[model samples]
Target: MKKTFGLLNEEEQELLNQLVEGMTKEQLLWTSGYLAGKSEKDKKTIKKERPDMPNIQVLYGTHSGNSEVISEKLLQSAKNNGLDMKISLMEKFEYRNTPLLQNLIIIVSTHGEGEPPSNAMGFLDFLRDKDTPEMPGLHFAVLGLGDSTYANFSQAGVDFHKALKKLKAQPIMPVRKCDAEFMPEAQKWMDQIINHFSGTSVVLRPEKADIPAGGPVLNGVANAGFTVPSFKRVYDRNNPFYARILKKKLLNGDGSDKEVYHFELSIRDSGFTYQPGDTLSIVGDNPPSLVEAILDKFSFGRDEEVVLDKQMFTLYHALRNYLEITVINPVILDRYNRFAGSKELTDLINDPVQLADYLYGSDVLDLLTDFPAKLNAQELVSVLRKLPPRKYSIASSFDAHPGEAHITVAAVRFEKKERIREGAISTFVVDRVKEGDRIPVFVQNKKKFKMPEDKSIPIIMIGPGTGIAPFRAFIQQRKHDGIKKGTWLFFGDQHEKTDFLYGDEWNKLKAEGYLQKLDLAFSRDQDEKIYVQHRLLQKSEKVWKWLQKGASIYVCGDKKKMATDVHLALLDIVRNEGKMDINTAKQYLNSLASDNRYQKDVY
Candidate 1:
């Protein structure tokens, strides 16, 4: 390590050592690249054409924008390393002509339930087709981003890797599957890929930047947080702004089965500016009761010290704030079974159906109680993953609610196995957090869900339940811009009387003629339990007319059920009313998606 830093002064060397000590392998790699970028900036050297180097085509597919972010990083790193790499979205890539591409690099994310992202669907289909051309001369590498909590984690990456192999394309390296905490792993993967093509290794240099106050300065590189158009002070996961809670109001009335709240957070001095469709990533604490229960089960002292993320903290504090204790995933079970030596747990993990059933509503406490394990504080903490921040759609327009971000959240409480289970972040916001409290937050920008710039372009927003969040922002934005017509919203809930979110606001907007059309579907009130999809079918004529008028459709909600239902309903409308066959209707929808006329932000 000292040999690598022979050029630095004593004080600078000490600082570098401290920084390196706290960083993960992937973070260090990124830090190295960041410093290299700085050095390149200073030298201002003209980049020579790398005609001799292999032509690399980098294609990325993303739903939450993570893959695109990483692809951009990879592209910049490739530039710094003097590599010939061209980046493209998977949707725009010519997958049918894959045999023509000599070198390929894919970074794609899996969407809901093992499905490829919308942008990658067509390309993946091409790969799976029997008549697809063989890419015998192609050399490729794949990196997949996904949440490990899902059963088919990183399935998209797995599919790409297998499909390319089946097409006779040689893999330069094995596919890398990254979990939610994906940046570090993705960076490491990029570095490896860059090194493979470059004639030399990437050189590390001292980073040059001012450390923001209260920021976690690991490896001398600050987290590249959200950026406004000004490009001032980036705030990210490691350096989230502490937004003060401005207001908290219950959206659900009495007699309603749901408990939803509208929260406003003041970002006055945070220098955070976001548009309507961006998300607010909230870093929340685990429920204290669940943390205590786990501590009691281990019979370990709450004061016992445990090291997490290269930092030391009391066992109780770690469980409460740092480690994940709310969800039971295969990763946690696999790690825990090492110390527990429970045959039943191992068997459950091996059987996908049984494992899914057990993990559905179970938490760490449930796992500990069901399979008792005698473990020390370090051992207990080691099995758990870092608590990932939860993202909620920003419910307030930046123009309408200046200096504030808002979210609509529903408390997740359910009865499972005779005990009440609660979501970590959802319950944290609903049950514990209050007005005036400051919580760590960052803006998660969704560029794909951007509102159309054309003022006359109509928007058909289909958002139900808490999914109504971003649409509120959209409506407020339209109001602020003084453009009101051509706005239609289809909102549904359990009942119109009690569960209709923002009912007053919607009515006021309609009365003001700001909302051109409004459709409501209160499922529970009807005998057949009609949802937004059913309403879409019922209004198929008008919906088809709006589509023909070049209306952009936005769907935000549950990925598993609501999104799928609405999609089928839309296909039905296109096929029946447009007088097209099922395949042509499907093509119409696909074309809509390709043209950016259809967008979704589902979870």
Candidate 2:
């Protein structure tokens, strides 16, 4: 490595190293911003205007504001290059004139399976309708944003690209899908657009990173961690703050088909604070058994040392703490197959359907067990993305608990092909963690999923299984503040006896008159499967009345299944009770979302 400081003395270098190392990412960014601001001078640049550039429009459909932000940034970048442009929200755009536009660039995000975001609902309907226009020479590009872990990842963008082509629109660029970690990828797509339009290639500037704690004091530049929003010194994925587990109790009773627990972590003086809808991100290690199995399969010694982030660790520690051992994504498999050079593995990955099927039911261990490939420690490490933290909704309110953060986790233990398979973080936290044990934790804020500011306003909550987490925080906050708001919770699980999580606390809330309504749906307790959406349907008349009274509704659970089902049930309710047709009812619900009266935190 090049020396950070070429001429600095030993003591001076050490002092500078300590100073940089001690600062957090947030602090570093703040300092850099300060320095840049001080160095800036207001100056005007003369531009050579060319009036012949084609006019462009950037349209966006966003659920949690990500797509909107990206689209706006792109619009600004376009203006910088003098590519006459305008920006429009998907909901507000006139569908009839879309085909008449000169150059169209649509950026949309998908949530809950392959569905377009609420803001884009109208746009989606217009595009897919048979009455929509067919423009033979309309040039366009599409960018889709979604988390890769979700089903139909970037499906909305892919669908848009195909639909535009079907409508005879010419593609200026291929549809690009950005993963959950999307900003960088989104910038790349923008770069492609700029290059095509202006015939000039440019790159987005990378965000400067924060210096990690440890350093060899070689020079001035310190070893740094990955990019993140720089701010306070609370422990995070890059620098996990170890928190002591204060309490651990299984919420399920005997003979239950599932295992769920409510756990509390002590963050009293760690300078960590969380609000409702925030997630308690746990950085869990791989189970020893799984780590050992991988070692056995590769015939690699567990004690072998490897370097990561300029730090050394044993192979076992690296595999457990750093590498993603469970969950096999296509990227990892593709890289692994390249290393293995197995024709069978290569062929399987080449088939999209087969690859998806294999990835869905398999893990990293599955690759080793099935292919039996031999790889050295460094080679194995190169193929692995870091084990990202598992984010569980914060089940307690800071207002209610003061210094503690709680989480509701369900253990994953299932049998597959004569061997037991487990969810990486789920099993690690639920089954293995002890009361006094310390675990790494950080807080992830869910800005869109927040309580209404009006305390007296009513909230209808539908959360089944562990999705009841944030609602727990809501009820706790209400009870603590003594807000007289009318609150309704529709909770469901397999059996009422076992999975009625936080039942005692809820009962107390009811007794104290803080809970206005409590609806329960136990799917297995009755002969027919009943869920929270069923409860919503049963109370359809009242639900419509609540909507009339300007009540906000919140849904949290499985995005593809529960959230979708609940949304359909809601649409049905609106259609029947509001005396509206299916289309109107759907629009009504979409309007609620647009108004921020309908919020969801499903994953």
Candidate 3:
């Protein structure tokens, strides 16, 4: 029996034939007694030795793919520690069954502005409702991921934690709220969770016992491509399509200070389809010049091969294609500090204020120039973060643009203390790549940012500068559908002569009565600066009337001032004209959000 156990208990054999084949801890204990004639005390002793075997069920509530990734990692960690676990996406798990969950862990990420992710919406709604179950016996921990910059930072996580506590579920650990750059903190939190569950005897059987071996595995690939069901998606950062650039033209005038490009890509044959308000995600390369400069400073050979994500590429290629070399985050600084040849740079990294100053004020190239260090190809790749895709508002309608997709982008180039800094992706598109070049791109659907389906509904648009991108698509869509409802556009720029984007198109549309009203407020055109918000306020009576008629309002522009100002103006319009107090006006706005009457694509 010992020889049999040894033969069958090899890691893979145990995982495949025992752990996943309905072998529970209690069943194993009973079987041990039958097979080896173990006394009851001996079986109890065996259970005591494996006391770390806690049953963990991870319920991930997320709309984006982040929670799925986190859940997969958590499941793997639990398996490595010999804990029986069940992981389910929030949509698959029933919130009403919370009372039945004995030992559980929840990893949820917030979506939109402090709302539950799309997949977790139903679960979150049920939990928030009065009918939620009382889970007095449940021992649970929650980890929330969000961006701290947003007003509702990890709000979903906080809400879930509070709700669980109210329902009498024991909190095994304090809720961990991770920010946009969450990997380091998340890894540490995961380590703590694994340590807390050390030495448990509970065992979990696989959800499906009779599934075939060759089925599509999910999550990350484990044990030679034997992945779980969660990792079946074919498109990701590792494998991206090389999309062809169909058209590229300058949006700004020749004399204009701002350089904005209007790019069009051909997705006709790529099986990519997008609505008017969706976003196009481009997987771009780091500027080759900057990549070369960093390598030259360290005297690193460009041709040396480095392995990343199990795939090998040359040092220069990896830096350009796979690694992030533009942003100077704290993690990158910490990694570089140890290898810095300069004492001053090392000291600066140790100082929190100095580190913050450096990260904010400098780019990746700035670090290499300030403190040169020696690094091999693979070591450098290990230190750098994975390059993330850049998202742009799709500026074309499928009905209007047909096979082509358009985007309005400002080529980011700025000077700080006489050193020129260029945005990695923007500069790559504008200055580096020529026409007919293939750039890897994908569509990121924005379900919330959409026009009303009703053709008779009116729309009020306030978009300044390149924020006018999506409105162009909106107008074209309305025209294509022959919508007779009123369409009012309030657009602003620096100067009418040099700053107006799509000037000719707007003029033609206005002439054709497609654009019912066009209000322009060029800030630099006069001594007194005016903007889209001022125009919005000026048209308050008409706007209020339109709103009363169930018209939808949309704002697309800079989030810092323009969007906020426009939002305030709308509130004021409703307050003064509609006759409501401040709180009442806020409620009115919330009603619009719920009813899908107020939509924004500001960034």
Candidate 4:
């Protein structure tokens, strides 16, 4: 009788593996089936020792917390299916482990200007680097979120998809990129990803698993800090303390054609203390006339009770206090058109150009009048974005103007088809609100837009129109601190006499030697438009010398054209005066941006 492999004890089993070296499967089969006479039952036992499900990992990169919400949903789906799943922020995960990942899913969001969100920087660097692993066994899917207004929309997602393909990882599902309003598309993409892994044993039912074991309960106290006896003051958008308006003066001179306002808000006992470069964000109500027009079109009683996000309030209150009714976006049009049931609206919603035309030409109130849609309170709130604060440059320094905040605002008033269109917050601050009227306000911290920490360094400011707001604060701060550095300001507008905002202030600063240089280019004062860029070129020698002496450049204005032109002008100076190639000049400018020497606050 011959010793059989299956019948051997544990010690014999270890010895058999050593005897089987260089033996092929055919040789083993022939030895077992004929020479060894092994039973068929032993062969079936070896086949059972394999993993039940494949290993998978999910990663997310997020900004403003939205991507994390989607990741939670994905994780919950994985949990229900009984799959071995893991989640991590892409930045912290080791890229060297990429070769071991069999199934992977990435959820990411793009920031402004098509840059990857701050959290994704490290992960992106590793993926783009040449040292990354060749992961042929891996399969991946990506979901990207971004805003469409940016020129390079979803560039990070596009790069990730391409990089994964280059590494030979099969796509588990097609990459899905969504805009700011991303719910429906995200849901659809998630469904497709779930379907791809359908054979996995684990299944997640979100509705059943989402709720905790205990019944709904109040978990925390409302207004925790307000419980203190000394915390008597209540500051909120709905109920704001009346701060006396100390000044409401026009900044432009008699001959000046632009209308700019310098406003002072008394913050005495308001508990608001802001630095020189901070922004004061105001929560403003929509113009009353616009609200009334919307109500009339919808035929809803103003007193009708409506609930929004579990809060009960009158329809009028919800519209005026909680919802955005002035700024229009595509998602708003998409949902409203469905509710409107009008042929014109239906066609407009389907046509992208028409939708854009509608958004450009009309506010939300205008849509209500043109195509009335009946909406219950909840339905209305569902379609609207929460009212966000309008940020204004804090034009007064705490050291200079104690107990008060100042802002320079260009009141936006226009006529569309002979109908007046008022800017919601600008008009509220400038025209409607009275002295002693309370305005809900908060500070928006600006880290990037700030004056040089070392006051002795020279500074150049280019601000036109109402873009002069932050520069005013900068000047006020420099004056208070008695900074001896050279301060050059390049101010421009429509005309010299009437449109020259803060003319007296700039004149005084110049006379006091606080302003080393005050260059003005009133476009309409001359026959040809003499803008800021032309003035920059006019003083290129001095500007180039200042740059050599380590002066930090700052620009605050319209981003669409003026900012671009000003940037180009700086590049021209680098190329012509600094004698650098175009590429080198660009690199120099980028270096300035990264080092915080170049700063911009443009809308």
Model 3 misplacement above 4 A: 1-238, 334-358, 368-377
Greater-lDDT candidate between 1 and 2: 1
lDDT of every model, 2 decimals: 0.84, 0.78, 0.73, 0.72
lDDT of 3 at 539: 86
| Tens-digit lDDT string for candidate 3 (272-356) | 6777778787766677677888778777888888897566677877787667787766667667766765779778767867766
The candidate maximizing TM-score is 1
Give a tens-digit lDDT track for model 4, residues 1-603.
Answer: 545577787778777778787899998878777755543224212232225323777778764455776777777777776557778877667655666567888888875456666557667777767866556667899988875434455767877888888877888877788865455467667667766776543433222111111110112111112211223364433234345567888777775434578889877776777776678867666777877887887777788887765666788877776677777676676677768778988788678777767677477777777787777766776777655557788888888999988988887777786778877778767776655455556555555577888898899999987778888888889999997467999988897768878888889988988888999988887689889999999899999999888888988888778888999999999889989999999888877765667877766
Residue 397, model 2: lDDT of 91
On TM-score, the stronger of 3 and 4 is: 3
Candidates sorted by TM-score, descending order? 1, 2, 3, 4
- Residue 481, model 1: Cα distance from true site in angstroms: 2.2
Output the TM-score of candidate 2: 0.72
Better of 1 and 2 by TM-score: 1
Which prediction has the highest lDDT against the true structure?
1
TM-score of each: 0.84, 0.72, 0.69, 0.67
Per-residue alpha-carbon lDDT of candidate 1 for residues 21-96, written as tens digits (9 for 90 to 100): 9798899999999988776422113232335334888899887788888888888877888877888898887665
Q: Cα lDDT for residue 368, model 3? A: 68
Tens digits of per-residue lDDT for model 2, 1-603:
435567776677997688779798999999889879776432222121225333787888876666876777777677777777777888788666675576889898887768777678777777778866676657899999976655478888988888888888889988998875566678888888987888765443335323223221111112133233235564544455656688998999998888998899887766887778788888676666888898887788898988875677788877876677777776777778767888998888788788777877577788877775767898888777667668788999998898899999998878777878888788777766677666667776655688888888889989999999999999888888888568999999998888888888888888788888999999999789999889999999999999899989999988769998999999999999999999999889988998879998888
